[model samples]
Target: MLFRQLEYFVALARERHFARAAAACYVSQPALSEAIRKLEHELGVPLVRRGRTFEGLTPEGERLVLWARRILADRDALEHEVRALRTGLTGELRIGVIPAASATVTQLTDPFCTEHPLVRIRVETSLRSRDIVDRIRRFELDAGIIYADGVDTDGLTSTPLYQERHVLVAGSELLAGSTAAISWAEALDLRMCLLPKGMRGRQLIDDALATRGLVAAPQLESDSVATLLEHARTGRWACIVPRPWVSTLGPTAEVRVFDLVDPVVTAHIALVTTAAEPASVLTTALTGTARETDFATVDRRQR
Candidate 1:
């Protein structure tokens, strides 16, 4: 089957809509449909479940999509390698980032961008670490910034970036007489906002609280760090956030920051990429940038 046909099939599987798939491929609906039909004929296996409207992929299609993605990724890597030899790296580098690392991802990307001026970078933030790992396996992301704890990195190359320290933040009024460090129990006693349980950051917090025989029953829960920080600024809620975020978001004068003690929780964050041999040129470059980068110093500078 031709690469164009594989591209159309993968787009159809991703979009799950014939019209949208065609739009994504920049082709007419009939052209995309015909391409997939030809691909099916070549493979001697039906790829799509046919209907008046778009139906999901067939079992064979589901199985073949994985191979299709790998083939396309390899093809793209070859093209990138050749292009880099002639004119330096020139393509989009897509990275998935967990919410906790959103503020500090610039430490890695900044240097990568400086060295590879022709390369464009796309950072997708607020992703769960598991989701980021899954996307990397599927070849959707060149690399990811994610928590290294409790995450399966069996087939991925993980390079430790930094330790993400948790901190308690609130308005000056809410913590009017608080010390430099607050216990987990004390932080939980106040009206609090926290990340939802599904996020890795929130899970870390939950685990830490569980050790102290305390459960977080925050009055407000959100996925956005900025939202939690904003609520903290209102002097109505205390939020636990990554210390690095305080530097990037810059807590206002009324906001107070305190270390989380009595079991200070820290999550190891890493840059993860697929462990496939002969790594893509962009992924190699990103891995190099990650190695040379030190986010702890960056955070210290920001502070």
Candidate 2:
């Protein structure tokens, strides 16, 4: 019945291993098991399928996990509200961002930090668009930045932040003085290092090329933008990247950027947050900043 027990159960459910869950909860295996046992006794229902090793949660445990997450989230929100009244916004804001939107995350984070200097910001860029939505639903993230297309937005509020314009990036040596835009068909003819097929950005590229009666066969596939950009920097391969990524690259002396033409495919990037009643204060601030961010102005300034 204790809050710690609920936390322990939630950790156990997520980790799916008694030892690992205990480690995550900063407790010993025996202590965690005892706590779960006490929780089950108090609730009068077996939450887990007990065995020598970690077994999946029981049907009841599945339901309890949802309730546990909401309870913990509500408790944190209450604390944040009280602290805000006394000390301004103070707490951690966890954001899950798709790699394509990685560079533009600062648009929201920077403003949020400036307004609420006490809040800590954490941006995780290793998630897919779907994974970002899933985390928001689970209350594991305050908000996320992801592509607006084909994402599950149920129970979430989405605000369009900017349009992602595709661009071709290559080593300056490879491109020489050629700065003209290239068609998708022309770009595919080069030795390309691109994001893997599993990523949404890669999928969009493939679909666009498919419409042009072409298939992308990348010379190298990577999930990391840095990795692809590094390959392009070697002067052996060209990569397609989003315009927002230019800001993150700092100085692009090694690579020349060209806008992609001949069927320009621009996708909208949105700030997504849970639409749960009484949204978290952090999510509110983030979405507000997203709404106010003038991407056109930011792009002009950055240029």
**Among all candidates shown, the one with the greatest TM-score:** 1
lDDT of 2 by residue, 1-303 (tens): 488999999999989999999999899999999999999999999999988898899999999999999999988988898888898889999999999878777777888799889999999997998999998888888888889999779889999888887788887777675656778877887899899988989988888888889999887899988788788877778999887676666676787777777778788888898888787887787777777888766556444
Candidate 2 similarity to native, TM-score = 0.95
Model 1 scores what on Cα lDDT?
Answer: 0.90
Q: What is the C-alpha lDDT of each candidate?
A: 0.90, 0.85
By summed lDDT, the worst window of 10 consecutive residues in model 2 runs over 294-303
TM-scores, in order shown?
0.96, 0.95
Q: Candidate 1 — worst ten consecutive residues by lDDT sum?
A: 294-303
Residue 92 miss distance in model 1 (angstroms): 1.0
What number of backbone clashes does candidate 1 have, counting pairs of residues 3 or more apart or in separate chains?
Answer: 0
Task: Give one digit per residue, the lDDT tens place, for model 1 in 42-92.
Answer: 999999998899889999999999999999999989999999999999988
